[model samples]
Target: MEEESGLSDVLPRDLASLFSDTYTEESHYQFCGQQLRITQLYGARLGVAAPVWDAALNLCSFFEEQKLNFKGKKIIELGAGTGIVGILLSLLGGDVTLTDLPHTLPQIEKNVSANILAGCPPNVCALSWGFDQVNFPQDYDFVIGADIVYLKETYDLLLCTLQHLCGPSTTMFLSSKMRAEHGTVDFFQHVLPKHFNVDLQWRNVEDNINIYKVTQFQN
Candidate 1:
């Protein structure tokens, strides 16, 4: 994970493909120009949060490119499975809140506790999509989600959750690998625009991942 002679730690597009693989147990990554070490505590369950995936890595790289000094900016990561993105942002200076289902909290908290030693450690909370009132703070400068739009039934709920968390100016970063055959991408496209203005920020052709930057278009 050597920097190829640049200020940013982002790997070149050609070299990023080398990292695409299913992480089984403990693994280390050079994320956003820093060493990100992660491990899987439990077995790989069907619905449970697992280890790092390609979309997560792409989101990390996208954050680096944005160059928004995260320090003191309140951020929220929806469906924060491994909490990798939120943890990395916290390390970089963001005050992050990592939210997921109740069952997913243990693993996410474990990752957050292990990785975030200084600065603002991310707050791990249990959150279900489409709640009228969430337990955690609602206002955030940015909301991030990675590989979260995979399920067919949860599309609207995901949008609702984002709507609830975001302020009028909150910018959201969502990364997902296309699953057109499963209607994942189409459903997301249909629902997302109703809430925010969606723009394709970057695409990783090698990994088939799309990172989108979303901003609220209405009050």
Candidate 2:
């Protein structure tokens, strides 16, 4: 798995400190036979959307390991923090869109701009879960998310957004760091299965991350 030092171990003790002025950080990874330099903007008060998380790295690894073909696929990544997963997919020839909360777009856009290919540039957009999902089309070939199922408050909203984004044949791959306190497992085990057929695709035992392959349940 891709590893980064510093900030991952030491986070600010003060809650207010997390909302301070934004600083920049960079992470490097190998994907699709190319070294990717991903620029991450931190301390901008963009919770969960600033840095590249472990789950995101693991998801990228999962995609490469599975040898999934992304060429010509229309993909959308939800809660696309740092836009790493979508960017990697875009590199693999997928027509990708990276989406997150409005405030999160700048960092995502920066990363997308920094790593633009000649003709495979990924689009960045603001997607506020349930509220703005209607603006996006529902026929994406693949819906991808990493570490997005933590908040209990937004469970329903996230589900609603997933429903709006997925068409009949759309497949979803969601990677999550299984933090018990955050109710991640409950959302995957109980809530998600109701609307989608969920299957465990991969698991990183050491990091407690799991990747699930999901598709809409047919009646």
TM-score top scorer: 2
Model 2 Cα lDDT, one tens digit per residue, 1-219: 111122333334564355366878788999658578898776646654677888999999998888999999999999897989999899889999998877778888888888875886998888887898999998899999998876667778889999898899899999998867667899899888888899999999999999999998887
Per-candidate alpha-carbon RMSD to the true structure: 8.8, 4.6
**Tens-digit per-residue lDDT, 104-159, candidate 1:** 77778878877877756888877778763365566789888888876656767777
Give the Cα RMSD of candidate 2. 4.6
Q: Any runs in candidate 2 off by more than 4 Å, and if so which?
A: 1-21
Candidate 2, overall lDDT?
0.82
TM-score versus the correct structure, for each prediction: 0.83, 0.90
lDDT of 1 at 203: 90
Pairs in clash, predicted candidate 2 = none
lDDT of 2 at 76: 95
What range of 10 consecutive residues in model 2 has the weakest lDDT sum? 1-10
lDDT of each: 0.73, 0.82
Q: Pick the candidate with the highest lDDT.
A: 2
